[model samples]
Target: MSTESATHLRDESGPFFGEFGGRFMPESLIAALDEISAVYEEAKADPTFAAELAELHRTYTGRPSIITEAPRFGEYAGGARIILKREDLNHTGSHKINNVLGQALLARRLGKTRLIAETGAGQHGVATATAAALFGMSCVVYMGEVDTERQALNVARMRLLGAEVISVTTGTRTLKDALNEAFRDWVANVSDTHYVLGTVAGPHPFPVMVRDFHKIIGEEARAQVLELTGALPDAVVACVGGGSNAIGIFHAFLDDPDVRLYGYEAAGDGVETLRHAATITKGRPGVLHGSRSFMLQDADGQTLDSHSISAGLDYPGVGPEHAWLSSIGRATYLPITDAEAMNAFRILCQTEGIIPAIESAHALAGAIELGRELGPDATILVSLSGRGDKDVETAGRYFGVLDEAALAASALEQNALDANELTDGEAEAGELDHDAALTAAARQALDEASSRVDDLSAATGNGVER
Candidate 1:
């Protein structure tokens, strides 16, 4: 085996990739990350941890997630044979549970009683809550108020799973703000609480720890794809938010110099529009959330609000290792627009009967481009990172696929009926008969119209007839 494969197959001892993976945190949290890292190192070596996690993988998270060949989707991509690692099919509906379960287990080993985390689109929050519930630990999720509104159902799901949901109302009230709140909470309650950082970003041990937890994705994909095709894929593609899912699959193929790795970032409106979250493509070197990496900041060193149809990819900074890899040209970073992602989202749902998360659709979009380039002979593997349940409403509204005109017509119809009722008021005045009935009927009609609008909104790109 090559050195990289040997390092990954064995227990992750000393950081394998580079200096990008280490423990750099506040002095207060340093000892905790150190302890956690040490325990994780030992756990990897111990057959018990391996067996336990493997059991959970088979029984709970459904390990060996299928690698699906998308023949129809591939047809548009230059006839390149495209395959997808269906991480979207994992328990809790995403690859996030992989890392959370490992961390929760580590928390048990460390005797931590409480679990805390920050969420962007609520996928990580839901995954963390699921692990906390399974482990019977107190779980607190900090979500930006804006994200809370956008992903309200996921917030409710987390609460129903026995997690305390805190809506952060700080700067911009988004993922970064929620992360700031989580860091503050960690600093304050470091003794009893373990901060479950979601991605392969943050500081030091986090990138390494989370990457180790998720490396199973690549491990399985590498073996499965080789078995199915008798050769490694030409390229591996994944979306980069905090870079966990991308790193998860990319790490295993690092030794395969013939295998090209591509990471897709969300280009909210467009890169030049100054409204995108394509950090690796357009950002400058800076430190934002504890590590030095490419960050979207203004001339004054102030971080800007990142835009994306998918809330998960709307981050101002990318993972440090991704930054290092980009610098060394080990991987290529590409940006996908909201329109292209939405189109891919519709295509996946229509073609494969799968509705991919908007974030994951970016990778699908990249696959479309790669398919065109590689042609029919090559094979590409894309990580379907998460599900699309959280983005249906947003996608509906963005594409003008919702029945706004029908809703407006219904509203106008109700208003006309109300006007006729007022003009034909022929009942008792003091007893408030006709006017009251008219007002109640108008409100009811308007509510029904609004309901139609909501229904239309929910139906967008769902492959449902209008």
Candidate 2:
């Protein structure tokens, strides 16, 4: 990367990054945003602020998250070494806590008694709620109605953290809608509420402030990787959803000329179709969620709805820094479809005994492709951004694991409809008892499955084995 371009990426002097980010918001919220910017800048200069945040990260948020080698998963990646920066093991099970803790401390400094936030997959909401509880502040989280159903587990976690969750139903009924509502709430309650912006998008200081909070991810991972492999990774990969986690892990390696950065976006179905959240891959320069960035907009400049099985990536616009990164060729952004992401999600679960967030799975999918392209001698570091505990239901439904009993019963019923399934020619010749054969259809199916097992001596032949 050119020094000029890298400066453009790492520059924090203003709201805009190259041609991407700027303060675009309603007149009513400008003053509040400016206040946040001022407070954040002051906090940035204070050593006491850094010390306090580091202490909180160490004691509460689980700082210096570990990295683990995914050797088993590496086999699927063409034997490339897959080292995972395990942000999933953090307290709230994601990198979101890093920013939330910082912002909550800022909120306290600003004399705010409440925190207003928006969430997509609910990790940010859970994190913000946790911070609110820690600081004795009231919390309210705006979430899309669709997300509330899909990520119900995180919803429960937020409520248990003593936060009120409002389900926004307007617009696309996803992350963007929730953000719109959160902004409106901030406009109304700016005096006593701090809108803990979740990702590296939104207006002005939000993108900068959020990224600063998360830079520790890359800093620690960089040193850890150096110690583990005695070299910087050949490539660092992460999922880009509004660009927080991606920028978090990608920041430290920006100056390393040989270290490549790859960010995977959510391709709900396929990038060829409209059902995708590949902002940097499919979008053009535009404004959404208070920042001018790469956005999925129609020719008329209307922001289009984004789709993704991973709720966190379901946004039409991405952070301005990502747009800048893509424009300057400092980073590569690609689309990973739902099927591809879920396949990697399951692969990590079964192979490495680690279940990653669906959002992070996109990064894993991209890393697999890069591993094949870069060869086995290469090293790839992936940001396993969050655990899959909240995604158990979604994964179960996606893999059909939850419907196993129903699937088996349906297969048996469908098999019974085919008389030829019972015998070769006796049934056709009317030499067999149809009633008996039909009655034994389910058992026959079970027996067929059991016969394939080498240790069937302990099998009950009813889809069960001793």
Candidate 3:
């Protein structure tokens, strides 16, 4: 079973994965966390719990997500085959479902009737809401106000799935702020609420448990790739934010000496400009969000703001396990700039017709470079963590698709103004008051275009449509 070797049959002295990962939390919450840890252990031992989870994976969440080789997309990557593990096909359209379902089940076993979580791009929030709806639990998700605006579609998805979305406006109004708000809620509602830490970053048990839940990703991919190619891949790649998806897919290959593991962090503008979220590449070890890990902080040790085109990857700190993995030299961590990531995103869409999440696009960017370096004979597996439906608006704006529509609309308005024989002053300033109407029309055009693009993307299954 995957559970047996997810982190493998190893014994550790405590929750610390090296000098990182510990329960650095309030005294009030320690007992609750310990109870969660104990319950998870007991659940792992119980055949019934395992069987139930396995059934859910088989029927509900779609386990053993397939690996499809991207030959056409590989052409640009120096002819090295680009194989993708399609977690995007999972329930709720992301790898997050795997962890949330497991955690929700545990929450049920712990006699909890409510679930709480934090989201940046809203993938985790949607997954948590899905699980909550399925299990008859009330769900509340904290999202940064900025993220709520950026990923407004996902906010709608969460609400439609029966979850309350709270917008956190403090600080930079991003992931860290949402995280702070969630923790405060958990502290107050610990009695009847299970705080589902969306990533593998929080304190001890969450980092361990979330990774364990998702490790099946790598386990399945490892076997499927070996059977298909008759050898281990040259490299396994994933994007790192709070690092759950990366660790999930990387854990299975940790013992495979011949396979190289790589994690790509988001570089918003450029790391040189200090506007990126390349935590491991340029950050220092510090405590944030209850774990000691690589964090973007100032000289005075206050956490700094992190930026990324992908809201999911715009985080200042990463999971402690990633910090430990980078420290031990087991995996190489690097940066992928926003422009480069969008380039990969465009290429994948045009070449393979696969619209990957902006977060996953960072791994795609890395895969391109790795493929070029490794050449034609090499094989690289990238974790396509989610579908891009939630990102269509952002992508349209980034690629200027929406802008083109706006320009056309503006031209039409100008033509109408000309037909009305309006003076230059009337057109540009006073009488021809079509500014608000044009703006509304542009917004509608962008939304319609984004929806159409999303519909087109849905045609692709695990890979390109044949």
Each candidate's TM vs. the true structure? 0.86, 0.86, 0.86
Task: Quote the lDDT for 182 in model 1.
Answer: 96
Compose the digit string of candidate 1's lDDT tens values, residues 208-285.
888888999999999999999999999999999889999999989976879999999999899989878999999987
Candidate 1 segments exceeding 4 Å error: 1-24, 400-466
Q: Which ten residues in a row have the lowest lDDT in candidate 3?
A: 5-14
lDDT of each: 0.85, 0.89, 0.89
Q: Show how many residue pairs clash in every candidate, following the order shown.
A: 4, 0, 0
Please identify model 3 stretches exceeding 4 Å from their true place.
Answer: 1-14, 403-466
What local lDDT does model 2 show for residue 404?
A: 43
RMSD of each: 6.3, 10.8, 7.6
Query: What is the C-alpha local distance difference test score of candidate 2?
Result: 0.89
Per-residue lDDT tens digits for candidate 3, residues 1-466, read 5555435422232377778888889998899999999999999999988888889999999887888789988987889999999999898999999999899999999999999999999999999999999999999999999999999999999999999999999999999999999999999999999999999998879888999899999999999999999998999999999998999899888878778999999998999987999999999999898888899999999999999999999999999888888898889999999988988998899898889999999999999999999999999999999999899989877764545545556665765566466544454665445655655665777677657555655643233221
Ranking by TM-score: 3, 2, 1
Q: In candidate 2, which residue pairs get closer than 3 Å at backbone N, Cα or C atoms, i.e. clash?
A: none
